[model samples]
Target: MRDEKWTARIEAGVEGLTKAEWAPDSRNILCFSEWGLRVTIWSLSTGTATYIQFPKHPDRGYAFRKDGRYFVLAERYKSKDMMGVYDCPSGYKLIRHFALPTTSLASISLSPTGNHVAAWEAASEFKVVIMNLTGQHIATFIPTDDPLLGVRHILWHPSGTYLLVGGWDSKLYILSSLEWKVVATIQLASRLPSSTACCTIHSS
Candidate 1:
């Protein structure tokens, strides 16, 4: 198996580095840089690249929705306590701006279904908030303890029934959409024998 994987990698040389995300159709890959503030689309088959100058901002992050129709572009200001989102392919249409109750935006994640967004803020405390695509606050889930680990990543289950949050503390949290409660928590390093050690939800 290792030998076969290596052979495929050599044949695919420099092909995968052109962009950060491959198009839903697998024809192109979308790429961007936080420092350069530029967005580029690269053709996977032809190796051609097209670049677009991104709007000026101190910090920027983007997520491509599953349908490939639009992208969520988040911008953080240098001196302001707010963040903004742009709805694309309409590019830079101010969807909504929210004032940070804290100091900075810790991280942002868009659900796979494209209906919701999750954002974490880090300041003297840690907080996570969920919002709808229209920028309305849907629900807010705050852990009792600071999780001591900041939110490193957030992902939505394909069924859109749950959100998985991974933190620097080496823990994974599975949250239910309907109840908005933590259904399960898996510790990073635990040798305990339990059925809840692994959590899996089937989406039909």
Candidate 2:
């Protein structure tokens, strides 16, 4: 019964899977809920799953390395922002933990090269913090002073030389990776409070 037989099944214990992302190697699955309080990763080869819980989070603040060797997250500790990097396969060891200056940090984006991570405020105009995987703070890009300046998304260019930061201000700031300066700004008609492929464009 080649056509009728079940090929495989995964018993992910997550009750409500709000979002799921596969590791670059396709050997692991990461699932999150709408609440953003917990995440579970299942190892396909080992048939085991591991979960990480958070005290609070404004958005899904985690990303897997391109090689799937480790994962990084914006974790909260005692009402403070902290970055945590965990090892793969086992997923229990906390290899690194770095304290961040702002508690409102959310929406994490690891650079394409997996060297730096960019995290921004979820509902405020706090500084966009950029740091390396070793927990060293590289730089911080300030948000607009306008009241409408809420960070919506932080995306690193494919070349990892610029960061495209957009938000409720209906504008995008292209920050040069070399100096972390705003190289250019693109204004849109509507509030850019979400990530979309159409809005992800390279700077000239």
**Which candidate's TM-score is highest?**
2
The best candidate in terms of lDDT: 2
Candidate 1 TM-score, C-alpha based: 0.59
Estimated TM-score for each candidate: 0.59, 0.76
- What digit string (tens of lDDT, one per residue) describes model 2 on residues 1-204? 356643446554546666677777777777675565677777777777787776245346777788777788877777788888988755546789888767677568899888999887767564688889898888988854564657877788888999998877777889998998899998886645556435666799
**Ten contiguous residues with the weakest lDDT in model 1:** 6-15
In model 2, where do residues sit more than 4 Å from their true spots?
A: 1-17, 33-37, 55-59, 89-92, 143-147, 190-204
Clashes of 1: 0
Candidate 2: worst 10 consecutive residues by lDDT?
A: 5-14
Writing each residue's lDDT as its tens digit, candidate 1 over 1-204 gives 555532111122332222365556566666655554565666655666555454232243456677666656555455544445544444334556655443466656787777887877653345678777666777877776666656766778988899987777777889998877899988777454567568665799
Off by over 4 Å in 1: 1-60, 81-102, 122-125, 190-204
